[model samples]
Target chain A: MWKRDEKKPVVGIFGFSGCAGDQLAILHMEDSTVDFFTSADIKFFHMAQSHQEVPEVDVAVIEGSINTERQLKELKEIREMAGVVVALGTCACYGGIQYLGDDEETFKERMKYVYGKSGETPEFLDLVGQPKPAQPISDFIDVDIMIPGCPVSEENFVPIYTKLISGLLPQKYPMPVCVECKYEGNDCFLLHGKFCLGPVTAAGCNATCPSLDISCVGCFGTYEGANYPSMIDKLKEIGLSEEDAIRKLKMFGGNKVEQALKGD
Target chain B: MKTYKMPKNVFPDFIELIKTKGKLFGPVKQKSKYSFEEIKNLQELDFDYQRTIMGVKKFLTPPKYKTLTFDKEGTKDIIDEPETNIVIGVHPCDIHAVKILDRLFLGNIKDPYYASKRENLIIIGHSCLPDDKCLCQSTGTDMVEDGFDLFLTELADNYLVWVGSDKGLSLTIAAGELLTEEISDEDIQEYVRWQQKRSSMFKTVMPSFKYMADIITLNYDSEAWEQFGEKCLSCGTCSLVCPTCNCFNVDDKILMNAEGGFRERMLDSCTLPYYSMVAGDHDFRPDRTTRLKLYYTHKLKEYIGRWGQPGCVGCGRCVTYCPVDINVITVSEALFGEVCETKEVCE
Candidate 1:
């Protein structure tokens, strides 16, 4: 229990090079917005407020992958200044969709495809210092905790926030989305010869898609110690070629999935 | 056991009489599958179903439920007294499954949650014709003598109702004029013929089911387990559909305000990840092969060792529900090499 006279822990919510969905998730906590604002000192959340600098904080919650040299330096600075560094979304934890192209040449080719061989885009790229390959924040700094999702789930976020504010270390289970799917009492899509990554995907979204009869695309990233060879074989049995199955597995799993597939 | 004969025409009125006892539930067809759903009238029930997607266990131990609610003051047990439930059209195998569950939950040390639901539930068994998926003949659960309040044997033109409990007798007394105590020779002959026909109609017989405990032990390290494990999706569908798979996991769900929370209990499966995980993330059964072995061993081998009967009632739910064909029939056949249908396992 915190005493009335105890100082509130300062928290900073920062975003880097991808969609700011994680910060939006925090803002979307409608019922608990007041409680969150009252409990902690949210010193620097640019999405919620402006005219704020990166101050020394008790906790630094980061979102998105590091795609630029400037973001890489700022990430290191935040790690040095904050007591606890949290990777708040799939991008910060696994490099997200932005890191799908792992090699420098592929990144350059994709950049050219999206922006064209035009002049203004090159100047913008020069300004950002040659546009490094998108990488997770943990590549440069030590991450104390990882809350992975395309947009972090509110059920996961709220409880982790509660524990962090209460000065307790939050714990997470490494179970697959199939666990939640079973509890939801949804029919298995795989049983009907449909492609679903639920057996290997992380559990957090509460099997949202499968509850509605849609197959899981595994946007939450792979669960720890996932049995990938069996998942790939199942996908193959469902009529997906081995290549397509591996591609779908790597779609959201990023470098971690790549390493796991390599190890297999 | 007191017996009565009711004409087919008066069965609807008997059902209506029992409706006043509690909310009536029976099997209803949903698209291609069947499930136990609440029904207000008699026409909604489809007695021709082979199996319901879920079983009678759903009413006893729900998929998820709030067990406790707490705040800064203290925690409160939110174990509300559930309403009375009358489940009709339950098959004999399901009745046997419930009896096994009773031995676990209502035995020596009773679970308050299960005890409450079990007390308020009324089981009305119904005779059914065996389909190819039915394997109850091998497990000796093809017919039930007890474990239900009332049991019905459908005849050509009449209904034979057997009262197995005082509640069933009370229901009979309440069902005045709809039933008659007179038992004619024709009615007896019809019931015997129906029983004989049903006993002969079971096509999927596991002749080696009784010897599975020994076979499983002998082939504990067989390569067939690895072959089945390779095909396993680890999706936990088998445990969810199995009437006897009653393991559960409990967790505390804190409110968004962080001021209060509730404790929740949800059904868990041994085949799923983290079912055997402990503190420091040390999982005793880390791979699918070991976990699948535990599931079958506990159901087929260990339960027999403890209760003198295997936990499986030959409901065939796992056979119908598992995405890949990894069920009792396949596992037992593979272990004993009785059938070579799954040739890879036999080899």
Candidate 2:
């Protein structure tokens, strides 16, 4: 994955089925965008650049989740060519919204709603193969770091990005979003009878949603050792069914919720 | 105290005069909530607004600010002290909140960043109409004896103003032609009547407010916290809006070159699970219930010990804003031995 250029780190930005929201987060870095682009040599970023060549880059910031066989193949190739892979958003980190599926059969059945006549198109199968249940980059490749957010906030991304470019191993804070929300002084959504996944969700976004009085949707993956069973009990106490709470927990990433569902 | 009377109609021109002095901020009605924002038009200032969505503590301590900046060049202080800014139409609870914040930020080491902003600040307090959500009256925060630059009490045709500081006197003198002689005895009586009326408007009270510190300490391992934690988003909303919760975190952001970046300040919350987490992920308050308990303990017990004042001024923002309705009053009552039947509010 080592590139010819020895001066600056060559970077490639990629996306898959999920909304390119995490990449869009890069654009929202208005204060640091110029410095970011100037510091890193962009090898391939189809979202921002016109001409693209997927040359071996030092690092790749991959957004979205792997859903199709073609995407899986592309992901493996990316892993082969990139030295360090950073999962750039909730989708790439937690399988995005596709994690809502409880099983493979249900995942395919839900795909029918998207593709329209899922079994009818031979052309689709020939090019992309069968759609798979969404999974994080860690499932397919050796991910070096994971930055989770719906559209990653600058405060979270900038520090991590700076660390990567500085050749330092990025440190991950396993705190929940409540850490940031408390700092910003946001009101608890659960108190207002709104279902917020903040208590169990990973911290980073500086509690963006709650600052503006919006409930956190757990766009960031679940916190480290997140107590999902307790969160489910919380949702139940707040008037949501256990199934509904589990479904909402699986809204972003299923790894933790799946474990909780299996009584982990 | 020097008193002046301004006709209700001349209030608009008087506001325009205040604008020339500095950036004027007042309560602006947004959909269902009111916020302290730049007052562009006189009509935007609500004379009888209920409460602002957030407390006035935010003005003293911003959400994000640069404390220091370091580079290969040199390290230097970069605290951006603001110019003279006026926050008009402040409610009594928030005025009391500012006072609590002042005791914290200005009490000990004297935070230079907070002092810089506080020095340039001017408060214009408004006597507002009370609603069911307001508990400031019952809590003795219905009126501020001091701390405001100018306090306005509206009468039928004019506003009864009390100049609390030299800054208030200057503002009052600036409105030379707009100002009249001392408020009439009838107007003073009207102000007194409004005070009584506001005092009678409180619908909710934390029965344990008087002995909150002792009550919270006595119930260190209360089961009610576990119940509230079961429904807690742990978003730290209570601490943020408490006005007295001034905890902060500082981080140094270095540029890739390791040459330069700013050391910035961010808000920190005790209610967060990570607030007590140590090295090697040794979380002291790993559970949500534990964290929530610590937050209440700080506000009610620890803070009261630190300063003579009780942390909560009964602004009731936490109750009004809690999405799931874990009221402080009800929770405190439960902590102090009252088995509450009502799950939502404590009356």
Chain A TM value for model 1: 0.93
Candidate achieving the largest lDDT? 1
Interface RMSD of every candidate? 3.1, 6.8
Chain A TM-scores in order: 0.93, 0.89
Task: List TM-score per model, in order.
Answer: 0.90, 0.82
* Global lDDT of model 2: 0.76
Worst 10-residue stretch by lDDT in candidate 1 chain A?
A: A1-10
Model 2 Cα shift for residue B54 (angstroms)? 1.5
Give me the displacement of residue B85 in model 1, in angstroms: 2.2
**Error in Å for residue B66 of model 2:** 3.4
Report the C-alpha displacement of residue B99, candidate 1, in angstroms: 1.6
